[model samples]
Target: MNQGGNKIGGADSASRAKTRASGGGAPSGGSPALSIVIPAYDEAGNVGPLLEEVRREADALGRSYEIVVVNDGSRDGTDRALDELARGDARIRVIHFAANFGQTAALAAGLEAATGDVIITMDGDRQNDPSEMRRLIEKLDEGYACVSGWRRDRHDDALRSFASRIANRLISKATSLPLHDYGCTLKAYRRDALDPSQLYGEMHRFLPVYVRARGGSVAEIVVRHRPRVVGVSKYGFSRIPRVLADLALVRLLFKYRTRPSHLFAKVAGYLFATGALVGGYGVVRGLGKAPILDMPVLLAAVLGVGSLSLVGIGLCCELVMRNHFYVLGRRPWRIARTVNLPDPAATGMVSDRTAPTKAVQGHAPL
Candidate 1:
């Protein structure tokens, strides 16, 4: 990002990223020092330039690096252009998704394929600066599982800005990360510190929260923000509603993520009690009726069935959530490899001495 905020991209642009991906190749001797995963959706205008800038920045950091661009089923020439650029830069990798599966899915695919000690994720658009990547990496090196970029003076339309504010509040509340910007794409994560199985949904916005859930600390730094100077935004106001709905679901899941039985039992108990009250009223009304059965009895019957059904559903979901907990714990993720084994710890683009490293890969303490 630049102070002037003229968001444009070209080979000479500082924000240019290089995604030279080759399919599951041999572990490439040792993993690159840092791997950048960028998600692009109809960002042909910006993607080209962002790639170039990432290459230059990585070189300046004095570390081996690889950049992977995940083209989220762009209808533009993004795929072909990335492929063409790959011919010139072996450090760049391109992952082309078959269709638009949203940014979360695109990022998930890139993370699964990445081979690096420290991982960085940013938008393919020129808004997120490659220069700021170092800042995030630096913070990650300070014993933080993830570092998020806070866009100071954002340069988007008012509606987009306002919507993002709402989302950040709700997400911060849920994840308890308390960062100002959850939607900001500029972020860095210690590869082994994040577990993919513990992630899903638009949850990518709350990567820090997910990391914290696994006992990782999250830090934030101010990063410059730039306005869009190319094609229109791919996801517009339509995403606002979806994001709010998803936030509600995330809140519910987080509250009862591990022990859902508590949540289910509470809901069921309340409903069952309410139903009993209705039935008691019905019984009293029936005693005063000319006939034993009446409209009140029908109302009571409907309420009883509805309450029972809700209770049953809640109980069943409780079992399902518990059953899946073990599945998630046992599944393969970025954490198990970095934490459990005797392998070296993860690497970062920046080095700091005060911070504790979560996972080790045999290099000097840096």
Candidate 2:
């Protein structure tokens, strides 16, 4: 799974096409070694050139790769252009969505169709430089499962930058991932490092945090950013509210990453200890002939109820978390097979179908 853009070559459609025409059976596992997923909204002007650049870069590195263009319900002519590109280039594949989804869904869709062991996701608007692939891929050599790109000098608007700065600060305070750029789209991830379905919302910005929650390590590398030459930025200032909400979710995830009980015990213990001190003070006043039915006594009574309320809240939260925590199943099991339950008849004890489904290919849900 040499994805941070490392050039690892293996069997791919082009090679297999030639091999089969020569009267030889396509060998098993003849998929591309890498998949570069680009999430495009209305970037018709940028898509073709970026796709070509990534293709050339992957080829130059001597790796077999597939470039998946996820045309996420753009009102522009982006889908038509992508369809044409897919028609002419065997290495290019297009996921034409009927309506505009979000970028996260677009990335998920590309991930679904991606057949490569290493998957690289980049913004199709051209801000994410293709050349940065090498740095990200090189970092993969150090045993990191995911390499998130850091844009040191982002070329976004002032409002976007301010929002990003505040979001980055919140994320840094909440999670162990110390990268300052959580919203950067130029990222490379090992296929097995993440469960495509385990993501949701504006939560995309905190993917590294989510990975670490599941026991995977992520690294970061500086990347190049360019101003958007075409297409409107799909992200807007309103996203500041969503990012803050996502920050809260990420913080909760990090706190309960391993055992869930510790989070509850710590908070509950503090509340109870505070209540005990207040109650003891009230008792001492009453015993010492100080005003027994004073404001201090009432405050102590309130404190005791507040502490009990906190303990009860903790219990309820623990139960809710338990249900979802075990839902992930017994740690890692290779999935052996996924039943979807709705499509139970689909065969293959271990179908190579994960990459073919909507979960990995859809955008934003952004």
Best by lDDT: 1
Instruction: Score candidate 2 by TM-score against the native.
Output: 0.67
> What TM-score does candidate 1 get on C-alpha atoms?
0.69
| Highest TM-score model number | 1
Provide the overall lDDT of each model, using Cα atoms, as 2-decimal numbers: 0.64, 0.63
How much is 209 displaced in model 2, in angstroms?
Answer: 1.8
Give the Å shift of residue 260 in candidate 1.
Answer: 0.9
- Tens digits of per-residue lDDT, candidate 2, 1-366, equal 222322221112222111111122222587676788887888888888888888778776566777877777777788777877777877787766556657765675566567676678898988888987766766754556677887878898887788788878877777756676789989887675555543444666776665565555677777789988887888887877666655655555556646657866776787677768776776766645666455565566676777667655754564454333234321111122111111212311111223222222222111
Scored by Cα lDDT, where does model 2 land?
Answer: 0.63
Candidate 1 local Cα displacement, residue 96, angstroms = 1.0
lDDT of 1 by residue, 142-182 (tens): 45667778896899888878888887887777655577788
Instruction: Estimate the TM-score of every prediction.
Output: 0.69, 0.67
- Looking at candidate 2, the ten consecutive residues that score lowest on lDDT are 332-341
